[model samples]
Target: MCRWLAYSGTPLLLDTILYRPKHSLIDQSLHARMGVETTNGDGFGIGWYAPESGSDTPAILRDIGPAWNNRNLREIAQHVKSHLLFAHIRASTGTAVQQTNCHPFRHGRWMWMHNGSVKGFHEMRRELSLAVDPGLFLDIEGTTDSEVMFFLAMTLGLEEDPPQAVAKMVGLLERTGREHGIAAPVQMTVAVTDGTTVWAFRYASEGGARSLYYSTKVDSLRAQHPDATYLQELSEDTRLIVSEPLGDLPGAWNEVPEHSYGIVHGGHDSLHEFAPIMP
Candidate 1:
């Protein structure tokens, strides 16, 4: 399993969310409180959409090393600014420890990351890979089930309806796994974005999913704790959705209900029940 965080708000230095928080993602990389494992140091990655002039697409920086010891990450985090970002720390389930296996996988304007695994991934890998469109298949650069799941969503129309397409892809994987006698085909807590909007899902073929959480009402928190230093420093529209709360700010986090998805854009947020797509 792994730990990840997604940010959608007024552009700010990456350090504000990745390092400044009391329980920042970098801290979670070594001291995760809710993940299956406390340490997720296999590798880490960060994806962010720079202003149009910065680059043609989201800039991705990935490495096969511990987040806590990455000097380059610290340097970039202090300078880069983006309205949408995805950062992940990995604890490999079955994949080799390589840079490509790090999360926050990118595709055009979209960036994705995942925690948890595709149960019996070795058994389902072939079928899953074969299902990807040839065009998309050629783009896959890694062997992690997380990356495979990303391509599967794109093959099934992630750009159009990310949540639905991901659900369909997961459903297909589960069905294919069942055909091969795998009762629990998928286990995932995934987050994705197309630069502007974000979609996060928590689900598993076995009915028990990994930990996923989102922040609470920014307005509510600001009103309740006007003196909270960070709350006063942040933009009124700032919002964070993560695998765990960044801090213990009372009334500052909400648990995403099991088997559900969350969407965030322009400071607004919504959640939907996750349903498997029938073959």
Candidate 2:
């Protein structure tokens, strides 16, 4: 189990969201309210797109250490600014605790992070590895099922059709798990981005997925709590999608439906049913 958050909107200092919230991601690293484990101190990572001349590749800073105790993280958070960002705190399921195992795995201009596990991952590892394209296989730098899942999506065309490719990859993963006698083959709440748009999925083979939530209508929130103060501080187009609501503001979050995927970009959002991939 892990906790993660994705931000897409006007560029702002990372600390504003990763540290300033009442219960920020760093706080959740030690006291996650809805994760399977309260503490996710195994490791952490952050990925952000920097303003460049003609490229959109995100610069990522990852470490195999507790986010709460990392002085470098605090320094960078205050200095960096980006329109798209991802931060993750890990609680290793069975993977080794190493820097490479940290989330916000990168490939080309794309970045990804996961907050759940692939059931019976050990048994399905080989089969899953064999499915990745050789090019992607060479790029895999870690041994976590999360990284494997990211490569799988890339194999199935993540850069082109993120939502569909992810659905296909998950479908294959669930099928392979069941083939190995795993009843609930997968449990994942994943988020992937290409520096421009973000795609998040909530699904489980057994139909009981982990928690995933997205912010409520930005316009609606502004109208309802016109003087919430903080609400007025952000750009009208800013949005956050996370493993859990960042705060308890009423009507500030919406639970993503089971077996569904959410796409956020250009000040708009959409959710679609996820169809399992067939063998």
Candidate 3:
């Protein structure tokens, strides 16, 4: 459905991943190899913690246009630096093409993006929207299953336990969808962050969700391929969880198993099986 990435590690210019890679996020917007569609030109957005501030909140920039041709994105990518960041290119799955609908949706210190969507979202939107806590519901600015999912997670306690909150959200969503007669209602490769850490998930009720991957330990990559020049410049803690591998560098990327979630921070990285819990 879409292409996105979540990066956590040493501070870096946003372009280092958004534009400078052999196949960057901008390039993927135009020629995505793994997305259901090749072009994700509906819109784009980037959210990153302020460089050197350790701020709880993040700065967000989004536009309703092809990222491949967005000069503004290029300008910011070259300047903004942060230890944690999220970038997404959207391929609308029946949602309006507008700035508010772009991914990396935010609230307070949290930022989130998704690559897959709920089946029959039109039928479930009203119920799902109503399920969100009223205070958070007022903040819902876009009409996409992804945004609803974000608010749902928030309503269920995203700030306290991201994985569990998301699990609870999925549970409620899937149950609601089934009530409305749709099976296998959720398919998602989602990433969420709160300045210092990032949580990523890949799951679907049908067991075949969209693809997701994460970079291996940078130091480990260097140890395995001492001659790989790029590995030398990156910080050892750098970790990138993306909808697809940025490149085909052997031993550099690992697929996040289907129906699983991962957490990435400075020194603690973990993976766990994901299962929905009905609310």
- TM per candidate: 0.97, 0.97, 0.97
Task: Rank the candidate models, highest TM-score first.
Answer: 3, 1, 2
Q: What are the lDDT scores of the predictions, listed in order?
A: 0.88, 0.89, 0.90
lDDT of 3 by residue, 36-130 (tens): 99999999999988745756788899999999999998898888888888999999988999999998999998999998989989998898899
Model 3, residue pairs in steric clash: none
Candidate 2 residue 269 C-alpha distance from true site, Å: 0.5
Q: Indicate the TM-score of model 2.
A: 0.97
Cα error of candidate 1 at position 136, Å? 0.9
Candidate with best lDDT: 3
Q: How much is the lDDT of residue 88 in candidate 2?
A: 96
How well is each residue in 1-279 modelled by candidate 1, as lDDT tens digits? 899999888788999889998999999999999999999999999998877666647889999999998999999999888888899999999799998889889888788898988878898899889999899898899999999999999999899888779889888988988889988878889999888888999998877788888887667888999887666666656778899999887888889988899988877889999988954
